[model samples]
Target chain A: MASIKDVAKEAGVSVATVSRVMNNRGYISKETRRKVEKAMEAIDYHPNQIARALQRSQSYFIGIIVPDSNHPFFSDLIKYVEMRANEKNYKLLICNSLEDPEKEANYISMLRQNQVDGIIMCSHTMNIESYKKVTFPIVSFDRFISPNIPCVGSDNFRGGELATEHLIQSGCKRLLHISGPLDLDILSNRRRDAFVITCMKYGVAYDIIEGAHNKLTFDYFWSFITEKLSPEELHKYDGIFCSNDIVAYALYIYAQQQGLQVPEQLKIIGYDNHSFTRMLQNPKLTTIMQPSDRIGSMLTNTLIQMIEAEEDDPHVNNTTVDVTLIKGDTT
Target chain B: MASIKDVAKEAGVSVATVSRVMNNRGYISKETRRKVEKAMEAIDYHPNQIARALQRSQSYFIGIIVPDSNHPFFSDLIKYVEMRANEKNYKLLICNSLEDPEKEANYISMLRQNQVDGIIMCSHTMNIESYKKVTFPIVSFDRFISPNIPCVGSDNFRGGELATEHLIQSGCKRLLHISGPLDLDILSNRRRDAFVITCMKYGVAYDIIEGAHNKLTFDYFWSFITEKLSPEELHKYDGIFCSNDIVAYALYIYAQQQGLQVPEQLKIIGYDNHSFTRMLQNPKLTTIMQPSDRIGSMLTNTLIQMIEAEEDDPHVNNTTVDVTLIKGDTT
Candidate 1:
């Protein structure tokens, strides 16, 4: 628990000399710097970071806000962002919003008060006004808050078109699209829009079914799909596109429990090529591969650039990554 | 953007009084507190957290270190921990070690320098010496570094025994166990120990396939599984137990791709009943449920207690949670 003053005293130098040595700021004689360094090593004195942040009026930290860290999509994104941030010598502060607006607001205020260099927001529930008022640079992921804020996401519309086209080409006469909560105008909505357009183009009659709720729960999905389609109605659709892999997997399980044959009776496709999709017992989940790692790396890179420049640029606000269709056994 | 001086000038109080009022410290009249509050509201002044932390010599922040956030198990654990920590008015700083000892050490140093009140470490590669040297209270999840450090994990031995017993009861005479990296002496090793003992008690022949390489990749798993079991040898075993859901999922997919009938030809069981396990197309994954959320909440609660206590207790170093065998289509 040695303080900077203790190191300075031991090194026979003023506190300012020790501070300069620690920050590599102000000029100090080589001998004096060496003495200060030796004293620091002897006492195992790690400089007080809070004090340094106060002196500089900035913390070289970035805060990331996500709805749920457990979701594979967000976790994958977080991993890539952390990797890129580390490469740039930036520390990360993570906040799990749990899809609560109040929690998201609290975290936003906390990040602001801490004077974080930048923020990467992936949470969907916070008020847009709150983000507009943020003094620090923010890069929104997937969700678009305002034209003034920067956002990075995959081309959801194209992903939807690709998935639908693949299903149609596979000889699916009727299609069903299982969508997430329609409130947030993000990639999910874009995908749904594209699904409708693609189906119309293929001259296929398509029906849209919203999962009971926004949260991807197995119970909710099971009930939603079962209640929406009877055995007779189920026979009509040959293909199903789910908003995400979780829903697709749920449909697969529920359909099997209900004694329905897969691929012969129904083909399933999912969004987000999550790790779990490959683990499906059927080994057949054709999915849209959103470049989660690339988005994360790009978000971090963009935020770091803004931090270094110390300004916001509306011109570089919306960046979209390409999404590819990963064809598996289902198609 | 408004500074304390502006608020003080508007409130008709000294800068020191305004500072004290903002922090809710020092003796101040009720009228003065109200006046400062009103001034702060009118000016939209947010206190600088770095300055407050420096003055207090402690940041009300906790650091979390994990191998990879992308893993479902870790991501789920992190979510619960973050939720509980937020409830307790503590912010979280996350560091992903990516299973690199050097990166782990560097993160620990950074966490220490940040003056975080405590740290919850789930990284296995972190050096034990570094743990001993940390000045802050640390609560380890899923991994034990030393006898003195507090560790919170599920009863891995019991989990392993239950999984093995379930497989044996399901008419499996021979079994194969796939494990994670063994050098870390983590819960996986404890599970392996119990698996051996349980197999011995039941007079069931079991073979263990070690996939404990530093890098866990598809190639490593594919090669290891293929090399360990020739087609004739594979047919002899009726059950497989995996250390984690990820490995089990990989085994399931590889087996199916190789034309092995699941549950009929190979009954598979995985630990950490992840969200994706049940979502598989065939739902052929019966696994052990580790109560990840409970583990996360308990670890945070214990860490908070240790951080707030006047003196540390040596007896509260090891805490264990119960695990349950989740019956699914695989068994």
Candidate 2:
């Protein structure tokens, strides 16, 4: 009798790969599956106890991986994702990777073992190569992990353009853009691109500031901004555009401390019109409102589509939602 | 052999209850279990196929039910819960009940079917009776769901006392406490009780303003506050203690619009020293910080303890964590 090990050797792949193919689990390519099946048939391999639980039961579970659920943006994403998944009668298993790649890997393996139907990944702690190997259907939020994974996000470039243009129109001669880490290859970089291009087009004297890895909390952001830019230096720029509302809020606090009057001595615009931003009535935050509800809805729908689609179906598609400029007291 | 229906009829309970007892799934009391066992013996009932999955395997999945994860308080709770659960090698299944009892019921049923080991319930939409019927090990956060179910929350009364006393010491002549709906049977109502007691102790005149249903979002709160009190009337109270930081922030906005200096004209204190409140550096919120992280850890630990305990274990226990008055610029 041929053993599973013999079949793997015959297939020119690892034994674990053969086991994954046999169980119809994880991201085994069609070509790889065919090769494994061919090798099994050639070797006349038969398992003593074939656990078909992976393919037998539909868990109706979707795993959501986020960097940190407590973050305002991700919390909104989680809420909408849960709502949309509920609409489709799918339960969600939330994993907060906490910016740890090892934890994310463990979560992925756990989700697979529990037979989750799909995953909606928002965390970018893990490398692309790791995501490429996932067998379950996945759709990323605001990131391009691989061609095999679909990505959904708002128009970051347009958001940046709108904010910069609004500040320019508000009659600010000197401009400054505060952004997240621009080094990451995420789609959000388009926002920075638009910021530079729009500033160049308007020929405004502008400089850009970046956060440490673009993941600083509000307190850290406050300290970073204060440490990097002195009150006098910050006053040099009459208009500021923060990458997100969180950072913009830090800037607001800094401006208040510096006794710089908003929209008089300086004007500011933020991105991601989060719920907290709406409560700011001092000078209501004029922000680029990312369609968070719509983006969450779209991501869940895309994951569900991929989950329900046939294996031969086209696996990946990129979708971009529109963003709107909300004019508030800031501009 | 007697059928399952016969056993339930003899026990004077529903067939579903019998099934739950057989599977050891939800919150069947020791008395109820004994009654069911007696009925089975009396009727000579034999569970066909005896799907004794009760002692079979541990799912190591904990279900979390919350009204809205996007809410700052709940988001903080969820993050800490996830972190603690991860430390224990347990995965979380998050459900946004959306303030609907039906959705919560459905989620409970689904989680039971999926063999979740325990549940940490934060939503108040479901009635106490509904929670009492649950078969899984359960812990209620900030709500006293049932005497049999353990609850974990902060010392709301002490928190209220600290906030109120701080306001008095700050030399505010007249005081007002804006609280959540006082009619609900929730533990948080103690904050209101302490507020009244402390005000009376200090011989200070204070008024109480209640929100509708104890569930107001930022937008709803803004409208409620504006409609209920004119800016001129609001200035009458020299000190105000809001139920939560969200309302305090709205008050701050109101103060700015009305040209009332925070702490100088009106000393203000809020509860739930949430992250957003910390970011409000202009007049940083002097609020009572609910020990959210400690509460989350305690709740997870309590649930895990109950899950791992044997049938004869006296597992039910209520625990309250302490709250702190974080002095910010408002006071």
Pick the DockQ winner: 1
True contacts kept of each: 0.75, 0.56
Worst window of 10 by summed lDDT in candidate 2 chain B: B47-56
Q: Which stretches of candidate 2 lie over 4 Å from their true place?
A: A1-55, A214-216, B1-55, B213-216
Model 2: per-residue Cα lDDT over A1-331, one tens digit each: 6888998899999999999986557999999999998897687564422022223545678999998888778888888999999888788889988778889977887677567789999888788898897766999988998788999999999999999999999899999988877656688888888989999998988998875554526788888889988988998999999888878878887898799888788898999987667666666788999978999999999999998787746566899999999988776
Q: Write the per-residue lDDT of candidate 1 for residues B1-331, one digit (tens) a residue.
A: 6999999999999999998976667899999999998898789888878777777765778989988777667777888888899888778888889888989988887788888888899887865776887767889987777776789999999999999999999999999888766777677688899989999999999998776542324455566667776777767788999887767766777777678888898899988875555444455468999998899998898888887777765355678999998888777
What DockQ does candidate 1 have relative to the true complex? 0.55
**Candidate 1 residue lDDT tens string, A196-229:** 9999987999999765334535666667777876
**Candidate 2 displacement at residue B249 in angstroms:** 1.7
What TM-score would each prediction reach against the true structure? 0.86, 0.81
Kindly report which residue pairs in candidate 2 clash with one another: A26-A135, A27-A135, B26-B135, B26-B136, B27-B134, B27-B135
List model 2 lDDT by residue over B1-331, tens digit each. Answer: 5888998999999999999997668899999999998998687565522122223557678999988888788888899999999888788989988788888987887677567789998888777887887766899988888777899989999999999999999998799999877666788889999999999999999999986543426777778789987888898999999999888878877877899887789888999976567566666788999977898899999999998888745557899899998998887
The TM-score leader among the candidates is 1
